[model samples]
Target: MSYYNGKRVLITGAGSGIGALMARELASRGAEVIVTARRIEAARKVSREIRKQGGRAIPMLLDVSDLDSIPAFRDRLHDKAGPVDILINNAGVVFGGEFEKVGLAEHLNTLQINTMGLVAMSHAFMDDLLQATRGHLVNICSASAFVALPYGSTYAASKWAVLGFSESLRLEMKERGVDNVAVTTVCPSYIDTGMFEGVRNPLFTPMLSPQKVVRSILRATKHGEALVQEPMIVRSLDLLKGALPRPVWDEVSLRTGVASSMKSWKGKH
Candidate 1:
């Protein structure tokens, strides 16, 4: 039997891209997936596709950035799907440009969706997760969390916050002796999800496929791994960042094109 055979999984931003892919993947593994997006039609489309493929899925509307909507959404999900065993915080937004070129509201919205939304969803479902015999919290962060990203400052900052929050929450759960609930933070380099549409991939750090990332996330969740950094090169750079001086790391980032990857970014966000 599939490891996810009886699991109840909830994924935000399931309308498209990574979130949608994760929902489909988990459902194929026998999970009962709650596919949610800010747009109900989009979520329904994904859920319908899963059902067509003989997987179980339910569509729901969820705007993670709207704090007031969270409780009602959570309640509805509980009433329909029972307690969630896996919560995937995958909803996020990114606007890439020079700090001055990006509007203030856009930057703030990036934080709202990427950071605050993740926090709100986690807070709302944490109790249910704790009650589950086996629960997992998966946060889709980015490699930018490990370093400064020029031209993508606000987006990077939001991911950095997510990484910190995930790590801290993991440690807190451990300290509190809550071993049943595990936290997994996925930090991958650029994904080919059109979200980073015109961004250049750094040398040796090619854009990752959503399938690869989803597989890694499931593997991490099963093994109770604390972190998942993909493409090997990302892990190397993260290690180098901690050991090198700020100026040295900055030079490396620039030389490797990491600092300027977003120069031509015309993403969908």
Candidate 2:
């Protein structure tokens, strides 16, 4: 028996990639998955497959970037999925390029969808988590949150923001003595999700498979872990960055291929 069994999990951007994979994985574990995406068809496709496989699933349309409509999205949830027991803020976008080459609008859109949208979802569904017998919040961040991603600045910034917010929320729950709901922030390296199509892998950090990352997420969420920083290198980020002086860290980043990893990035626009 898994902790996800019977849990009503809501996953954003579950049209494809890691989001869709997570939806399927959770549903197979006996979870009642709510697969949401901006494109209704995408959501329906995933839902249909889950149902075909004898898993519980509900497909819904959700544009997390449209902060105003999030309330309405939550309201609609009451009619179909009901109050969610697990909220996975997996929707995100990327405009990978040199700092100045990426348009201002693209950079801002990255933050809007990746950071603001995530915050809005967390706010809108928070009450449901509070009321659930066992609730969980999962935020799919990135290894860039801890290190530098030169060509993907906004993407990194958004993940960094998510990391901070997730940590704060987790601590706040602890302070409030709210043990029913737990927060888990997942930070994985460059995933082979086609999002980073042209990016070079950092030394010793091979591109991760979506399935592997999703499995780790489920395990961490089930165990109520605070964070999931993967690839072993990620686990040592804080120590490496914090212990080294500014100039020394800069040199280390460059020498380790982390700084140049995104120099040639051609991600999904």
Candidate 3:
């Protein structure tokens, strides 16, 4: 849509997986993208690839876990390009292990990147976004946000926080007369990214492709949708999980071996 044309989009975790896919898709559609990754070299490579395709892209070194880097990132961003029109909080980490077996440091790091990072980045750019009025903030959440699996307790907790934060922010923005600034949250099933590579889905549910997920996000942003859910089947399952009794659902989860797969996946990797 014309709304996306020439939009300045800022995305985190843009080195690979869904983050990189979204960057390429947005650039191809006429958006100037600013991509940040923990690894500076990976960011540069992605930037180069995008440029070679005749798209506008700039790479920056960013580690969401490192709070000290935010101010510098903000300054460099403002110096290079003006305020970003769209912010995609897509950087995240997953530590797979039995809840009791997982170390406190790993759990804390997961929360730091997935939850705290989103909050800090949004606050750092809130003023600019509000001034623009016509802006969008997209948070990439997971199906874990709705239901917590055995090994994903930490990941699920972080995403649940994100889901709540995004919705509440949307409401606050509305009261400020910044109706044009849309906040959309996306929840998808396991992706084929290396982070979750060896994880098996006992149900044989086809893992959603990052590209398709990106397209759905763009579509939602264009249409002003508040929430974007991929693979209608996944959405249905979410509803089912909520409607069923907790014990029953827990049994289904245990019997399906969903938790075991995620926990065992760590060793396989």
Tell me how candidate 3 scores on lDDT: 0.84
lDDT of 2 by residue, 62-143 (tens): 9999999999989988986589999999998898878898899999999999999999999999999999998899998888
Model 1: residue 269 alpha-carbon error in angstroms: 6.6
Candidates 1 and 3 compared by TM-score, better number: 1
Q: Is candidate 2 or candidate 3 better by lDDT?
A: 2
Model 2 clash pairs are none
- Residue pairs of candidate 1 with colliding backbone atoms: none
Model 1 residue 17 lDDT score: 97
- lDDT tens digits, residue span 39-143, model 1: 999999999999999999999999999987998889998898798999999998899998998999999999999999999999999998999999999999999
Whole-model lDDT values for every prediction: 0.93, 0.92, 0.84
- In model 3, residue pairs whose N, Cα or C atoms come closer than 3 Å (at least 3 residues apart or on different chains), thus clashing, are none
TM-score of 2: 0.98
> What are the per-residue Cα lDDT tens digits for candidate 3 across 122-241?
888777777774788899988777767678788889999999999999988788767878899988877777777767774645677877888898899877678887667557666878
| Top candidate when judged by lDDT against the true structure | 1
